[model samples]
Target: MSETSELLSGLALGAFRLNGQFLQIAEGLARPAGITPAWWQVLGAVLREPLPVAGIARVMGMTRQGVQRIADLLVERGLAEYRPNPAHRRAKLLQPTAAGREAIAKIAPGHQELADRLVGELGLDQARQCLEALHRLSAALDHFTDHP
Candidate 1:
């Protein structure tokens, strides 16, 4: 294999490894609030404002059906609610309820502490550069997939 192909393979492996570690961290951060990381992710997506099911799915990098299932659960558990959407009658908007906000608040301090520690280790500029590179890489992959 070419050097570029070998490097790309390494990048793919790194992404898979990072994804697992990230999910594990999310799981721990969310547990104290009595929510799974997936639930926390769904709620976090809607915390800023109400969004339709499809919108939430797009923003949260989740499947529409998966988000719908979680949204239903959130409503059933009193963490979220579906309000009638003026734009689309059938597609109601999902928003975080007071309980949802409270749950997220419970996790915020720990999340911030972790972030602070990471910043101490990595430095703010280095972290921002890494984030920018990741975004660029994601966009490049997206472009290639779309074109292909």
Candidate 2:
């Protein structure tokens, strides 16, 4: 195999491993507040603005059905509520409730602690560079998928 192909394979493997590790950490950080990692993810997406399920899925790079399921659960639990969307008649926007914000706030300390530990281990500059590289890779992949 070419060197580029080998590097790509290694990058893919590392990303897959990192995804699972991050999910595990997220679960640990969120479960104490009675939300799953998926719930936390959806809530995080809408922290700034309410989004329809499709919008949330797109923003989070998740399947629409998966996000919809979680959104429904959040509404059922009173952590989120649906409101009429001015843009789309059929699709309602999911807005995080005060309770949802409080739950996420409760997890902030744990999240910040983990972030600090990772930065300490990796060194801030290295960690930032890694994040920038990963973001660029994601953008490239997204472009390819869009054009393909």
Candidate 3:
């Protein structure tokens, strides 16, 4: 195989491995809260501030419909609330409920501990460089549209 082909293959495999690891860790962390990893991600995004469904969808790189479904579920579960959006009358702002904050707070320490372990294994400086490279790669890939 050519060098470029090998590089692409490696990138694909690395992405799969990293995604699997992330899902595993997230599942473990979210199980106690009776939420899925995806739910945790949505809740975590709104934990800091309220955002409209479209805004959350953009931040998460998800379709607005998908985020709306998750938001509805969160609201039904008492983990989130939908408030009127002054900026857009048709859109509602999503905010985490007290329960949502508590759920995230409970899971955060374990998540941090796992991250600390990984950082320690990689050495902090090396981990930082690796993350920086990944961020650049993500930016480059973000230009591609899935259906266009």
Candidate 4:
């Protein structure tokens, strides 16, 4: 194989494995908060402000339909609510309820602990470099995908 092909394969495999590892850690951290990893992910996307289901899906790297289903479930469970969107009538914005925020609050300590542990293992400089590299890689992929 060409060197570039081999490098791309290695990067892909590493990313897949890292994704699984992060999901496992998220599951563990979210379980005690009475939410699943997927739920936590959706909620985390809108923590700062309300968003339409499609926006949440984009932020969470999920499909709009999948985010819609989760948003409906969250509403049913009293964890979130739908508000009329100013931009679009049919597409309502989703925001976490007080209960939802509280649940996420419950996960913070564990999340921090895990973050600290990982940072310690990686060292602060290395962790920052790793994050920067990932960001650059993602941006490059986005650029290529959009252009191609």
Q: Write the per-residue lDDT of candidate 4 for residues 16-113, one digit (tens) a residue.
A: 99999999999999999999998998989889999999999877668999999999999999999999999999999999999999999999999999
Steric collisions counted per model = 0, 0, 0, 0
lDDT by residue (tens digit), candidate 1, 78-144: 9999999999999999999999999999999999999999889999999999899889988878777
lDDT of 2 by residue, 77-142 (tens): 999999999999999999999999999999999999999999999998999999999899999899
RMSD of each: 1.4, 1.0, 1.9, 1.2
Question: Model 2 compared with the native: what TM-score?
Answer: 0.95
Per-residue lDDT, model 2, residue 52, is 96
Q: Name the TM-score of candidate 1.
A: 0.93
Ranking by TM-score: 2, 4, 1, 3
The best candidate in terms of lDDT: 2
Q: What is the lDDT of candidate 1?
A: 0.92
Model 1: clashing residue pairs?
none
Model 2, runs deviating above 4 Å: none
Q: By lDDT, highest first, what's the ranking?
A: 2, 4, 1, 3
Per-candidate TM-score against the hidden true structure: 0.93, 0.95, 0.90, 0.95
Better by TM-score, candidate 2 or 1: 2
- Candidate 3 error regions (>4 Å): 146-148
lDDT of each: 0.92, 0.95, 0.90, 0.93
**Model 4 TM-score, 2 decimals:** 0.95
